[model samples]
Target: MKIKGLKQLSRTLEKAGQSGFRTEAAKWLEQTGTDFLDLVRDEIVRAGSIDTGSLLRSFKRGAEGNIWEIEKGGLTLEVGTELEYASFVNDGHWTGGKEEVRWIPGQWHSGRFQYDPGSSSGMVLKRQWVKGTGYWEHAFYIFERLFEKRLNERLQTWLNSL
Candidate 1:
């Protein structure tokens, strides 16, 4: 989108802070980020698949200096964590079987022992291949439409003031 009075805005931003280009870009990025996050949350919530409320509640949308990031949960993935599962839900996961094993906590005077899942021999974990729903794609499509429509007006208004 063409932002009117960009040069003027840049100069003003630099005077107010540091890098004007970065500052101006951050404003637009934040606006789009908010829209993206909201639309994505709405889509996921309406789909009623995973816990959209929790996912959306932890959604992150903002810029770090010149970089803009939109993330659903933690920045990094940790095994056995909600964020890991959320990643699987968003992109789907491959079905594979590994020898299943677990440890039973000590009880009374007994010590913990390695437990094999399924019968005496070993059991293969069931595989469930889930197809990706392209949840993010749907949200991006909605966000694009919204930003395309509103960006010009917002930029024009901001420019006028500048």
Candidate 2:
């Protein structure tokens, strides 16, 4: 994920320095939030898949100035997407939730045109039972695993930089 508006973040940190405790807290939170997003994006790309690029692109950091204010970052670090189908890519269908059954109406045209036996033309009702196996391919979970392995080294580097 490409994080935008760091020039503004610098100004935010400066303002936070002047505002005392609350702003200082905001500054720390913003840093951690942005870093976490970057880490997730890196992990997603490294994991690599057909939809991984789009998924990485979907991860966004709040605008820099907004990072220090309640309207955007501050206590509200928003790092997600407007992409409607993100859930489908993250979690394979029917795997994220419990099993379900859907009842579909019987129709003549649907039966004759769509099926070979055309046995569904009967007036009797039909139910489709969807069994969910919990086939989880969620990239974030992979990222979590990678982060766990690297956490100590990553934290050590960041602390040394400070």
Candidate 3:
């Protein structure tokens, strides 16, 4: 008995391994990043966290003046946000002094909190904590599962083509 088509198989494998595989993988990774960003924006909207649409717009591609950044390279993907208040919105925070009662210089308009130092209207509270909306956290939780499933499907399709 003799083995046949080994040469063709080897050549195909080599070609795939050189650059084709990397290019395909990078494409899928970039797509996944885009999908993840859309998912996060949808989650923010679903959670009713849109105030001025700043956070929603921040989750996008590119680097200049954007809070969120999505970078893709050879078989690597990176997703992050530069907004400092994002964590606070997702994790919650205290309103004023936790140890002592303090006067908070802010005003409530139509059930929304607005910080105004010059405004005469204000509120006093102690150890008051605002619950986190968990929009980002929820989006991440959802995107984790989605990314795994999508990556597997994409890889399977690529491999089948090979």
Candidate 4:
């Protein structure tokens, strides 16, 4: 007896096992990244940090903002914002250096704080430090759990298909 179509069988198996797996994994990664982005936004909302919606919009996937790279059988996903004040909002900061109380030159209009150096009306903040909301941190913690569960399910499904 002679083996026939062994080369063809090998090629087919390679394509289905390797390339197919990579394709499926990439899809799952992209979906997870999108979900993670939404989670971060939700966390920010939960933290009551939505002021101008700029920071929220900054958390996107693509070359313009967040990092989303899937190449050469490798995957990389990062969700972040370019807004400078995002970190300040996520992490607490001192209102003023070595000052117990500081007068901020901002006016409150429509229940929103607006900074105006020339504004005569201002409010004094007596707190030395503002508490961090930790929205990003909380989002990451949630993502970790979600990612593990999703990965396991995807892998199991993929293996079953094979």
Candidate 5:
């Protein structure tokens, strides 16, 4: 498995025993709150007879990112959520924290995650967008950015009491 930030959030999230913001975020993202976490959670798509690259491009990544081949039929998605990243427990919750693109405890940390499903192998590719900080919650980072622009406009109008 590939592990990014071997010393920080990466390690924390992987731990079966929870701790800190990483653990909290996981719980929050799974079964609580408001934001659509499922859309941003780590994803693993089996080849499923479809062309993996084409399938990801069309249905998953939109138009960017590349695919890494693992085994005969296993393929890895450059983007997607790990189940632990955001458990089904909390699907629509707000991942609260400071810093944009930070490694919050509950959310999945950002990095260059790689998966080799054939061998049941995967690793966090978390290279922080910010400097100095180690691994941060990744799922939250993806959650905020993916939906922030849309939410802001809606919230502004709703809060106006129109």
Candidate 6:
């Protein structure tokens, strides 16, 4: 929420080298997101308070980034690669919704999502508004490596912890 001690953590991560940062981010993903999918599914099937036809909210992770959504609504969450490159798309699908992208400078000032893998990662979601078709985009990304893919690979680690 407050990102409590983010400044301190970031400093320490940078000092320890890129691998340390990845390990830390991966840990965050494992602790927060892994079971969210299952929990939502359970709520839909049993609570009956959620729409079951399609996910009311969905999450996607890759080596480049991560995304969060609420079907037919607005963007809810996002996390991008290690370079701070982000594309947070909220509301509807990209068809008409807007996206917020965060840009991070990587090793040699590169913006590649997976070339280095040691410099960047995060996400953002853009939301849409009814007035004048306005859209709100939230973004957090790192442009160093293919973060989304890495996120996917590490899912099992999260599951194991669960």
Residue 76 lDDT in candidate 6: 31
Candidate 6 per-residue lDDT over residues 45-157, each given as its tens digit:
44243333333233234422334322222323343223221122123234233565444434443553333445564333345342211111211122113346666666545
Candidate 2: where are CA atoms >4 Å away? 1-19, 50-52, 62-74, 94-162
lDDT of 4 by residue, 1-162 (tens): 768988877776776787577778778888888888889889998999888787777676753445455453676655576677788899988775675787778789999999999888898877567888999999999999888888999887876576
Model 2 RMSD in Å is 12.5
TM-score of each: 0.51, 0.39, 0.70, 0.69, 0.21, 0.24
Q: Mark the regions of model 5 whose C-alpha exceeds 4 Å error after superposition.
A: 1-35, 40-138
Ranking by lDDT: 4, 3, 1, 2, 6, 5
Clashes of 4: 0
Candidate 3 lDDT for residue 36: 81
After superposition, candidate 3 runs with Cα above 4 Å error = 1-12, 63-74, 99-127
lDDT of 3 by residue, 1-162 (tens): 768988887887786797478678767777887888788878888988778776777777774335433344435566656777666777888875658886768899999879899888899767877788888778889988887888889877876677
Residue pairs in collision within model 4: none
Best by TM-score: 3
**Model 6 poorest 10 in a row by lDDT:** 132-141
lDDT per residue as tens, model 5, 78-150: 3332324222222332333333343322232375443434543443334332221111244455556755675
What's model 3's TM-score? 0.70
Q: What alpha-carbon RMSD in Å does predicted model 6 have with respect to the real structure?
A: 23.5
Give the CA lDDT, 0 to 100, for residue 45 in model 3: 88
Best candidate, lDDT-wise? Answer: 4
Cα lDDT of model 1 by residue, 37-137, tens digit: 66766766766646445555555443111123433233322111134455666677766645444333332225534454443543234656777656667
Prediction RMSDs, each to the true structure = 10.5, 12.5, 4.8, 6.5, 25.7, 23.5
Candidate 2, position 111, lDDT: 48
